[model samples]
Target: MSITPQSPASPAPYGAWASPISAALVAAGATPLSSLALGPDGDLYWLAGRASEAGRQTLQRRHGARTDEVTPLPLNVRTRVHEYGGGAYAVHGDTVYFSHFADNRLYCRGGDAEAAPFTAPGRQRFADFVVDAARQRLIAVREQHPDDPASHAQPANALCAVGLPGSAAAGAETVLASGHDFYSSPRLSPDGRMLAWLTWDHPRMPWQGTELWLAAVLEGGTLGTPLCIAGGPQESICQPEWAPDGRLYFVSDRSGFWNLYRHRDAGGPADAICPMEAEFGSPHWTFGNAMYGFASAQEIVCTYIDKGVSRLARLDIAGGRLAAIATPYEEIRELRVGRGRGAGFLALLGGSPTIPLELARIDLSSGELEVLAHSIADTPDLGYLSVPQSISYPSASGRTAHAFFYPPANQDMQAPEDSKPPVIVISHGGPTSMTVNTLKLATQFWTSRGFGVLDVNYGGSTGFGRAYRDALQGQWAIVDVEDCIAGAQYLVQHGMADGERLIIRGGSAGGLTTLCALTFHDVFKLGASYYGVSDLKGLDQDSHKFESHYNEYLIAPAPHADALYQARSPINHTDRLARPMIFFQGLDDKVVPPQQSESMVQALKRRGVPVAYVALEGEGHGFRKAENIIRTLEAELYFYQRMFGLPTAGAHAAVEIHNL
Candidate 1:
């Protein structure tokens, strides 16, 4: 099924070009891979998203040359600790502990046996686990939801220890530390005598500020009074790990960058291990993020982001000299050190422009690579793939914004001569997150269909140090939206895209950027919002506890917040929105509820503006099921074709556009 290049005799219009990359293929090709963990027996464990099976996440194990499923069907290996869960499962020897998404109950499975619930089924969820074999217990972050489902109170998060079966207090959870708004990354010392964890308060996201706590492990699996060794309201800390030699090492932005630091003693100040402008850490949007691990007592292997790209390196702990470790990946999402026979091996989830995200184990001694799992079983040929060009463009107020520009790249199709392809500007979610140049079929689906794609890493994005990340401190919508517009305009000005057909689209926070760009300005001709925020006020009300007070940092606080929310809300100013737009919403989404998209769609319909809405049932903030992913991609493509008056492929269902 090789696709040969087409001759330049006659070309189709940009939007109407035929592509081999169908919507169905995109859904099937993009698999989610995350949370790499190395077992004591040298077995590799990770999570794989099952799109065909209702988007259930299954725990996967790689032992020797064989790969198998660890968690049985109907027992999804996930957690809802922060709603955006990670570190859902932890492995110790042959035993695995995981949180079931359905009941929020912690389940324990040993070897090939059926998984059994260990924690009492209630409104409690757990994540970021550490095994305390010496005490026959598991230390983790436990989020206790109020018993009253109708209550408006936020869930209480704390560091708790769950007794393993056969222990004196089997199935019982002992709260070790409380009074924190959120808790994560409970690490045990090599001797199991000490524990270190991270906590942060409300109104400040983990990336904005957090505290690292260290405490002595008292007898009977209890913790002594904890001491805050580093971090505060002005400093953000992440990934606090205990070195094999018993020293505490963590990432801190105290130097205006997330540099590595080591605390030799509780009473002494932490020493900077390697202070550089590069980011050795990322925003703590989810749980269990490890940027570096001890390869030995004196050497450390780490992944760092420099100028929005990731690089693998080895650091000499004593000399603080960093030496680059060559790898094919341009982005490393997760990293962990191997154990036992796998010692000196680094297990990571990594990818590059031509490679889909994959689980790989790299041998430090021999520089050998072994891929354990591929996000895409079979990726598209390189001829049809679009290699991204890392770009920096001038944005509002003479500030430079970064993005990855992907030009139309289909081997079998080409647009007419002198006709620039229509571009789709993508404002990535996480206004706090940074987008990498990893090979994503979703972006390729657009480029392969004669569309240029610009993935913007807006002002608030992580990487490039703390000051750059703080650019969106109180100017979320304004700064993010301006960056997206600037990226699109840069492409048009440089003759890379059609000036008259600029399109913008985003999801979650990025959705807010898309809506603002289309509503407040006339830069984008059309837009698409996938579970985007249309009304800032409504978003704050419907947001979960993890992000309830997030707006206090993204915008203003208290009384002044209401006015800013009203002024920035796209739904409030839809009267200025005359562009054609399509909206997608998941009925079960808790982050940005369906009302956000529905309200905007209704506004557009009433104003006689061409608009379409596609709602998916049983979906959450993001579409996970294969069918829904296919449907959304196809419907969006069809919508753009019909709006541009281009010939539709008609290979998928047509979207019903009102006021067309």
Candidate 2:
């Protein structure tokens, strides 16, 4: 579907802005894309998964053309059955090396057409791996579970190697490095003489701080003493790749925004090839990859967000000239540059409004783009989808906050002539994240059903730049909650929503904002939190490896964690939570344990406050299964309908609403 250029005179509402809305919707629940790797036969491979029933997730191989052909590997092959699976995968000839669930066992897929486990069920946990076809070994980041109490909080992740396409007991895996809290993105140098990877420790997210390490590959296929080549306390390294030349390249957030940086050797500092004020690196919550790719060793093509719009830009590494590559789309995600066979291949989303995500191959020589794959089958007709408009509001501290406002679009279901539609204020997760202008089916689900959505970027979101991202550093619960409240107030003051019927909803971190907003403020009369962090202390203790220390920055350090944790935890302030609330949680959630929600639910029940809690038995941090997604969506909708005395959409599932 093609979008007609929207004129400035006919500016769309914040939610109706085509580009930002579509991008935001697309990014809302996008999984971290595994790094794009080209197979020996030139076939591209990446990890793909979807939300599953009870939030028990599944990750499978997604090849070109056969996107629907998902091969579910054994969930218990490596990690626990309940844990999320599939990180980075490497395909060498007929064999595949990838991470499995729980035990983090490295699995090999080969032989019969059916996928059978090659590695023993209980073994090593692998992060990212590279197939050294010439050496006939798999170079991977192996993580060892810690034993001691203080160290139990930190796992031992190191670079290791093992014989591949062979017996699991053939050779003992050799650890190349140790003492690191986390390890990832192990890339073998082109000449096979060196290796590069990223590592960082406690209290720092990859975006906050990380270091890139490089080492020489020894004659026996082991790594020499690893050296800190680039990255430090102030910079966060992401997606480190070795160029065709011997030089190593990566993305760093040294200059406020994540930009491309290259290093010639392990001695000197990394040079920034492309620098900008927008984020080039997303949070490494999942394993795929991010950033611009090397078109040649000297030229790189990447997607960069500038002023909230994603654009494709070409950078001359040698000359330092950054130029925009014009496309018909306003936003682009998952960029991969493939050379050698043709001009190069890049995966991007083009156009606006009803246009879906399409993979495009760019001809480096001719500067032309060819459509490779389209995500949506049937494109909506013109005027069917509402375009989002960018709106800025003065936040509490006077900083201008960003949000996309979607007007009530379904013509058949207009609001009462005298009153505006009720507004649903959406707070995106990451409090460090931003809302984009991408078309999404989920948002459409609400708008099509007659709700106006105001997706707030709030104070700490990324797209606005570094200062904005750091705004929530110590003010986590406070700033994010206020921004969401301000967003709802903005809608009411603008005559775009009925102030009395305002509702707020968010999941995960967004869910935390939803809960905090409801408890600390009186703006929202009704709210819903999906697997949100109710107790900050519980989150610090129960979260997995990546985010265990995240609260140090969001709230406070460990010993002092109790005071801040108690004060910020919504469960402790049930007396102030007079508004009706609905919560959805995964019983298997390690990020924010089930007890977090259970405590809140029980407290609200005892206090005689209206509340509903639905727990998915086998789920984790987030709901994945299609049935669960549909069920949660419908349940929340039904809860709202009942609370507001609106027309019922049939008899929904009986949720135990407390104090009803």
lDDT of model 1 at position 618: 99
CA lDDT scores, all candidates in order: 0.90, 0.70
Model 2 stretches astray by more than 4 angstroms: 1-35, 50-86, 110-114, 146-154, 167-171, 348-353, 365-382
lDDT (Cα, 0-100) at 346 in candidate 1: 88
Alpha-carbon deviation at 648 in model 2, angstroms: 1.7
Best by lDDT: 1
Residues 1-660 of candidate 1 have per-residue lDDT tens digits of: 334455542378887777767777777776798888888667889999988888899999898899989986887888878999998988888989888999988889997788998888788889999999999999999999999978877899999989997788889999999998999989999999999999999889999899999999988668888989999999999999888788889999999999999986937778999989999999888898889999888988999999999999999999999999999999998899864454478899999999889999888888899988889875777888999999999999888999999998877776777889999999999879989999998998889888899999999899888888999988989999999888888998999999889999999999999999999999899999999999999989989998999999999999889999989999999899999999999999999999999999999999999999999999998999999999999999999988888888795569999998
List runs of model 1 lying over 4 Å from the truth: 1-10, 339-343
Kindly give the stretch of ten consecutive residues in candidate 2 with the minimal lDDT sum.
12-21
Which whole-number lDDT from 0 to 100 does residue 631 have in model 2? 67
Provide the clashing-pair count of each candidate structure. 0, 45
TM-score of each model, paired residue for residue: 0.98, 0.88
